[model samples]
Target: MPEISRFLGMIIAMYYDDHAPPHFHVRYGDREAVIRINDLACIQGNLPPKAMGLVIEWAMAHKEELEKDWALARQDLPLNKIAPLE
Candidate 1:
């Protein structure tokens, strides 16, 4: 997994494993969730309440970049650098 962004101690990463969708994994402490790229919604697992809120907010703010990165990742190409979110 390559970390692409971080916020509120929640790390957003891309995982390269067969069968995994083009999504980002959010991790905070022991909590984790796989957020789908197409919809920017949590598809699997759970995250801490505050972490989840922050993740959702951050994802929404960076949806465009996130989707673009996901596409590049799916093609096994180098990811585009995303600007840091406030």
Candidate 2:
């Protein structure tokens, strides 16, 4: 697992050669979210509403970067660190 971004107590990460649909993981406290890269939708897990909103907002801003990261991950290559939410 490699962490790509973190902000507002949330940790966003991705795994090398992970499963299908191209998704990233979000963890905040005990809450977790698996957001799909293609559609920016939560495919699994759950987070607080406020946390979910923040994650989605961040995702929207970095969609392209996220997709690039996904590609790198799928290829078992090094993942770049994305800018944290500001």
Number of the top-ranking candidate, with TM-score as the measure: 2
Model 1 Cα lDDT, one tens digit per residue, 1-86: 77888766778888655255667888888878998866767888998777777787787888888878877777888776555457
Q: Rate the local accuracy (lDDT) of all candidates.
A: 0.76, 0.92
Pairs with steric clashes in candidate 1: none
Q: TM-score of model 2 relative to the true fold?
A: 0.96
Question: Which one wins on lDDT?
Answer: 2
Q: Give the TM-score of candidate 1.
A: 0.82
Tens-digit lDDT string for candidate 2 (1-86): 79999999999999996899989999999888899988888999999998999899999999999999999988889999999988
Worst 10 residues of 1 by lDDT: 14-23
